[model samples]
Target: MADKRTTTPAGPSTSLQRGKACLRCRKRKMRCDGVKPACQQCTKAKKGDACEYDDGKGKTRTQLMREQIARLEARVKELEKSSSSSSHGSPPANLSLSASASPTPFPLDMDSSPWDSQWNGIPDFPAVNGITDSYATEDPPIELAQMLLEIFLPHRHQVGLEVHVGRLRDSLHLPLGEQRHPVLMNSIYLWACYLSRPGSLCEHEPLYLSRALAAVNDAVPNPSKVIDFIQASCLLSMYFLSNGRLLEGSYHASAAASLAIQWGLHQLGSTDLTVGVIPCDRESTFRLNPAKDAIEQGERVLAFWQVFNLDRCWSVALRRPATIPDSKHPWTSVITPWPQRMEDYETGELEINSGSPTIQAFFVHQAQVSPVVGGFSTFAHRVKASALFEGASRLSSSWYPRLSSSPSFTENFRAFEHTITRFTTTLLPLHQLAATLPDEKTSLLLIHSLAHASMIHLHQPFLEDQGSRETAVRAARSLAVVAKHISDTDYDYLDPFIGHCWVLGSEILASEIAQLQAAWSPHPASSELRVELNTLLFSLTKVAAKFPLFGYQATKVQKLLDAI
Candidate 1:
């Protein structure tokens, strides 16, 4: 067939031979069928344009990458030097005045600022040198701020401390010289320190807390700064509670509630035409438009709930009555819509309606009918559960002394029980699902644990009746199981509020075990109860290893167990 095998090309051999592969193929460690314009591998990858060969006169690809990296390193050094030089310049004198006049003034850029040094591990904070005045006008060290935020942000939503993440991040980018709310900054730092690696960051807790406390103390009297004051107060309250400083926490919690009422946040959605108008003044205008942006409005809604949550939670944690009574004047008069996820407000999915039904409306409506699906937030569920638990605590405390003499006690008790049952039925499927994201899981566990705890509190006094005692025991045992599961799987990720729930649930479990031991005749359930209590205690100790407050409480439980 025309000499069958075609004559071989004269100049170059047709047989493929390994030559210098294209740079792309060499880098990828793939064999290249060295074609002139483009290698077969590159062509097949659709990266023909990227197929480059070493010209034999230039550096290799590895050398080129090294040179480029060196250039980038040099550029970074130059920028750092420039930033260091610029930060020494005096800041604008009107910065403080502008901050005061503008409800939400944008801060100066952090680059080319003294605070930039903090990010590079340089000590830029004046407080680092023991100068306090510099702190009043400067930002906290950026490194410290970042570390604290990293520790706190993940836990914030779970604890009902949802600050506007976008706004907070924006504020952090401001130059140290720019004026910002000290209370907010300090409160954030304080909590960050409290939640940081226990021994490493704990020392900063008192310093930041003192600053936050001082700022809030001064801001609370100024009507123009009421919003800042309330926010700081809420943060501090939670900080104190997490550290087991109940009295101080309660004080700040009560103060936040007072501020909420004083600033009329509770009435933001009120449509009562009978409400009288105050004279229009600068302060009044500020109060009316404090939430000038969507972020601030979302913050206001969240702040109110934070205060409400604290009031409800601590009432049971401290064995005290809830300060905010349901259906009471200001409590029921709140006109602000129930808080939504921060993302919803940030993305404009949720619009702030001027006359939306208040959170109180949902509670009132829920009391008379079935809970509306998606009517509230996971936070609202926690608040509702806490309120129910508080009611149970109140009933138990007041009625325990004269259970038989209180003729109406049984009816009131039944009503409370019915309310709890109704509320449980309204929980979102996500809240009850076994598998969820870490944050959702923590919320779910807390809500269910609190509900079970409320049941135990409501029925423990009625333990004289066989049915009531079994119900109480069952609830307590369920709570122990839940606690054990959470500690087993989510101990490291649990919120600060979880520690409070753990304490409550563990105590009940421990009490039940103690009672079982004290029985004249060993009950068939004793061994099972003992096993559950041991598992729960083991989980609590694991949790305590992380949180000192839980550690303290866990130790107390351990002692009780030993005695039993």
Candidate 2:
């Protein structure tokens, strides 16, 4: 596969003399034009050095840090073994990314676990015929598709922020009853699930999960609604199951599965097209069904929850020495153990409402705030002038290189540029809103959103830039302060996940910044920052792994003792 590269400008001419060297020139250890994007010298060489991105080996923080640490440890072992000839020692184990303990040891085995029943154990959805045709027209409605383009076409970074923050509970001031927006409700549940801290299943699960489920129930009956409700229920059930609420959690999970099956069956026969109001021509240029997407997405969620529960159950079963021999207990002797599935954890690609006419309205409604636009409906229409922000640039032009050959690319790109200008220019107000939020939960929500966004942007395949790294680092610093305060207050639940997320995010961005540091020949002070960042990553990793709820305190203390 061709490697994705961020677009940079062409190089300058050899005739153009300048002080600052172009990146191409510098990489080749030659002269630079200092002209933005491209320089004349590199362009003249036909080097096509327009790709200014440093892939940086694309190594994740965990992978890079582990390799570095392993090398250091090997050196230490070599020295120690040479000094003491008559000693045998085992290598140290790698540290886990769970929680740590304080002076007292953390009890890791207090929670009960139950094995989740498979689909056959519960009621299964009866198979349906003629279902293939339903999935054939998997496009968004023309208007909604256009709207999605408009709202998301410009200021994609801001749009990403809206999508993510809208997922957390604190972002919306609407009461539980009033917070009926599908995007907001679904996002919050996912955020809570992603943000679970050590031992947080006791409190945080109930608060957010209950509220989210309520909002899901309040939404219009649709496939998306069923998926959201079922997914949230599964998360809550998993939390409850971990906390030893077997009967209650099992009942809830079972109910959720039943509902999901019904919805899945319904989706096979129906079309989803209700999020928009305006009618388009009968010709189906674009048609989208969020509920149908939800049905498939729900299955993935269900499988994940099942695996999590099954793993917990197996762990519980293995807590004590097994008396049964492999021959006697064949089920227990299954060869392959369940490892965490990475794909299930990241839902960035799910197209819940693709190409739907209502999606344009959705973005307009999302970007709407009181006084900034008239009423909610009016707010959506006003943004409609820009096609709700969708333009050509937001579309992955490179995915279909043929797009550039068509004149529409130029039109869409220009429109997208305008949309970007409008959205980016107004984001300061959103930042202001975040700055003024007094409620700790709300504040944490804002900070968490910012932190997640910064990290995501920094890691984006095609969009990783200095601005994204800077944004991530700054957000992490600010969020750390707020998280500290929240931890000290009644809103302690906000602290645990916030710290973990911030540390992980900061480490990733900081590592990338280190690469950029090489190009700028940054000052000694900046070098010091980079050094301290290494220490920060280690300390934060230790602290996050020791968190009381999810921290696996017993194992951590054991590792700490070994270190000492």
lDDT of 2 at 210: 34
lDDT of each: 0.59, 0.34
Best of the candidates, TM-score? 1
TM-scores for all candidates? Answer: 0.68, 0.30
168-215 in candidate 1: lDDT tens per residue?
766677754333477877887766555543333444455575577567
| CA shift of 192, model 1, Å | 1.8
lDDT minimum window of 10 residues, candidate 2: 332-341
- Candidate 1 worst ten-residue window by lDDT: 96-105
What tens-digit string does per-residue lDDT give for candidate 2 at 1-564? 233334555455554443245444644566655544445665666444331312233553234333543443344345435434533452212111123221111123434222232323433222222122111222212332222222221221111111222223232444534433443343333233233233222122232333344454454255434444554555444444433334444545555544533333212211233221111234432222432343243333333233223222222222211121122132222111111112221343322222222223223343344222221221122223222211221243232545536688555544444443344344323333322212323333433333333333322322345654554455444434433333222232222323334444444435545555666766454554454444434434444453433343223323432332
CA displacement after TM-score superposition, residue 557 of candidate 2 (Å): 20
